[model samples]
Target: MRYSPVLDRLAGLGGAKWELHVRARERIAAGEDVVDLTIGNPDVPAPADLVEAAVAAMRAGRTQYSDGRGEHNLRESLAARYAARLGRPVHPNQVLCFPGTQTALYAVLMGIAEPGCEILVGDPMYATYEGVIAASGARVVPVPLRAENGFRLSAQDLAERIGPRTRAILLNTPHNPTGAVLTAGDIDAIGRLAVEHDLWIISDEVYEELVFDGVTFVSPLARTGFADRVVVVASISKSHAAPGFRSGWCVGSREFADRLLALSETMLFGNQPFIADMTAQAVSRPSEAARGMRARFAARARYLADLLTQQTALGVHRPEAGMFALVDVRSSGLSDRDFALGLLDAGVAVMPGSAFGETLGGWVRVALTVDDDRFRTASGRMVAHSLSLSGQRAEA
Candidate 1:
């Protein structure tokens, strides 16, 4: 048997970031005292009501397969929430629930992009997007977004990149490594381009509720006249700190929703009924609980920012929103990978920016997943290591 060349290519682009995390986890299990800052899995606890809801749901025997689109109740509930949040009225049929945002994103690519198509992605983007696009055999066009520009996506820049073969644009706002939110103006510009180019837009607003410092997250699809061509992939993973639940949803026009449903049937079969029930509860009461979790991430981001500023070797543009901070160690002698490995040897774990892509080699990523006390300790350790590396480089 032979595998596709695209799958082979994706396989070669190993998930080094996750591999390092597993190694770090093993070290911790072996009593090595590793401070993990690799993965962005939120450390915050899920809401008490959510937990109780899941327990009740399981007890009520709702653990079987659900509607491939979603359990109707949960789909309607999430649709209603999105309608209220985006201030755009939508019907329940416009939504499709998936196991998580990853599945939803993959399904979007499968449903929309053709084998020879292209997707415009931020250069230093979330790594999973690369593999997802590759698996679809679509060319993943790199759109370079720099930290100097606050990781903002420029319309003129993207305008030059989109072409006839381009089928869709993947917008991960409140972005992964940088936590940069797309402003209303940015969304409006992208909306205009999407309309003109006749391109489908996949808006990954998973971190929509995690904004900080008064930064608002604007979705590209939230604008008028783009809803028909837009598919929203969102989850309770980051916002509710319930990644383990594996519950997420996609929303679009009824046509797209049906296409996603057919894709889900051939791909996923359906979502877990128990998880859907729990998420329904979470989406319905998504006010105070969501706010409190965002506040915790904000506090962590501030603490890490202050610590990074002390080490002149590391330039930190504290994310305006989201859970990860992209700390630039370009001034230090070591490349991003060596610096991360150096920290690992120091019993601290961090993600090298190269995991995002080659263009991001000058930075290291730190997750604010740990609690405050641990975050302070990790930040201190990182600063010390950065200064030590700087001194060694100067001496050389």
Candidate 2:
């Protein structure tokens, strides 16, 4: 029996990057005392109000089918919330709800890109990005996000890479792995390039609400004159600590959403109504849970960065937002994967930055989502590993 060509390429696509993380888990399951800091599961629970709202909606029978654009009330809530944030009016028609950001991205990619086209994504991007672009029959062309630039995607780099075959620019701010937040200037400059090229701008803002103090997140959707070109997908997963709900929505021009409606209807035909209702409530007001996460993540990142810097050859690149921190393992003279494997022996499991993209070959990412005690213990192990590497360097 034969399968689709897409599945042939996507067979556990990007799964190889997690081999060390998987091995670490296997060791722990075998009763070994390994500290796994690999994935970013929100340390906090879903807010009580949002959870209660979901229960009430379920009991009231919100389990029925909804249109691809999702419940009108939920769309309305999203529109209003975005309107406030963008300081512009937004119609409910501009919002399309989906199961998660991942689905929204796939649908958006399918809607905009096709075979032989190119999507310009930053290097060291989210791991799943390539798979989605591949599934869309579009090729991903990586534009390196230099460490010197704090890993923020630059308009100059995009300008250098834009070509006739380039159909879209995928933007992820408050980015994963590196946790670099794109400033308003960054968006303004990048949006102008999108306009010049007449290319679509697919913005993944799932981590928008997770920005740390002293950093402001700018979305292409907020840029003037690029409304039609900018489509943003965000969710309550990180903001409200409701990843299990699978509730997310896309915000684009009314025209884009209208066209995407057909594709979405064919895809999942909207998310769970109960989850949408819960998210409607979640986005209508401020998120105290997110606020706490910001503080906690910031503190943990700083502590780990300082600890590793002071005690070993490792250099930590403190994040501007999100729940993961990157440690530069180049000084240890090991590839990121090898360093992660060695760290596994040290009783800590972290993600190799190379799993994200080529530019992160010398870095490893650790989650700040772990409890403080575990994170601290993991930090100590990393320090010991770093010291050992330094000792080897001295001997050499």
Candidate 3:
């Protein structure tokens, strides 16, 4: 059988991290003890109230399909919350709901990008974005985010990469893999560049609520003139520990939202109404669940960062936001893939940085979603491996 030629572009989609995750899970299933930190699957349970709300919704016969756009209540609830956060008026007409943020991101890219057009992405971006962009018939132009710059993407970098065929800029705040949160000033500069270039801004703020150490999340929509041009994609998976619910949203201009809804209609008849109800409850009600999750993740992040920094030769950066840290393994004298496989052999699993971007070949990303004890054990093993590598180098 033959497949479409376009499918060929998805050749290296999941990359090394996903492959390691599969291998680690296989080993664990075969009775091997492995501390897996390769994926950001939250170990924490969802809030009790959220679970109850879903049950209530199901009992109330919300199993039927909602409007293709989303349930009215959920959309309004999300709009109000975003309005409060952005300090501006965000109407329900400007919001589109999807079963997952990943799907929402794909919809936005498909809506905005044309075949052969370019989408500017920062290096060390979310792994899924690459495949999604390629599938959308768009090319990804990655701007390197150097460790010396604290892995921050600068306006000058964006300016240098913008070309005539550039149609959009995908920005991830509290960025995955690196946990680098963009400041308000950084957002302002990038917004100006997007506006100047007449490019659409697809801001992936999935980790907006996972910031650590008192760092505030600044949405691109909050910038002065870019509100009309930016589409903010976020999810309850990270914030509410409800990945199974698969609820997420896109906020943008009314026209953009309408277009996305039309695309979503063609893709999915509609999202699950009961899940939408549960998501509505999660976002509308003022609960301390998300705050508690953030605090717990922050503590775990700090613990792991301190352990890696003190006990290993690897360079560790304590992330300011999000639930992962980037550790440099260049001193180990191995590529990121080899280093990750070695850790897996040591009974631990972590993502090789090369999976995120070509420029991050000497790094590895460790998740903070695991329990304290497991994370500590994994950190110890990594430290021991690093020491052995150092010893071998010294002897040679």
TM-score to native of every candidate shown: 0.95, 0.98, 0.97
Off by over 4 Å in 3: 15-17
Clashing pairs in 3: 99-246
Q: What does candidate 2 score on TM?
A: 0.98
Candidates' lDDT values, in order? Answer: 0.83, 0.90, 0.86
User: On residues 1-396, what C-alpha lDDT tens digit does candidate 1 reach at each position?
Assistant: 998687685885656656667778899999997899898877767778888989999999998877877888898798788788779788898988888899889888888987889999887889788889988889899898876678877787789999989998899898888888888888888888988999988999998887885787777667767878999999998888788888888888898887677778887777888888888878886545558757877888788777778656578777877788888888876788888888887778988898887768888888887888888888888888877877887798
For model 2, how does the per-residue alpha-carbon lDDT over 1-396 read when each residue is reduced to its tens digit? 988988875777878877877898899999998888898889989989889999999999999999778999999999999999999999999999998888899899999999899999999999899999999889999999999999999999999999889999999988988999988889888889988999999999998888998887777787768878999998888988988888888999989999989999998888888888888888999789999999999999999989988888788899999999999999998889888988899899999999998999999999999889988999999999888877887899
- Order of the predicted models by lDDT, top scorer first: 2, 3, 1
Would you list the clashing residue pairs of candidate 2? none
Instruction: List, residue by residue over 1-396, the lDDT tens digit for candidate 3.
Output: 999856898885766448888999999999999998888876688888899999999999999978888888899899999889888888988988887899889888889987899999999889998988998889999999888878888889889999999999999998988988888888899989888989999999988877775787888888757788999999899888888889998999988887777788998866788888998888886546567767877787777778878877788877887778888999899999899999899999988898899878999998888887888898889999889888989999
Q: Which candidate is the best by lDDT?
A: 2
Identify the superior model by lDDT, candidate 2 or candidate 3.
2
Off by over 4 Å in 2: none
Using TM-score as the measure, name the better of candidate 2 and candidate 3. 2
Model 1 stretches with alpha carbons more than 4 Å out: 4-6, 287-289
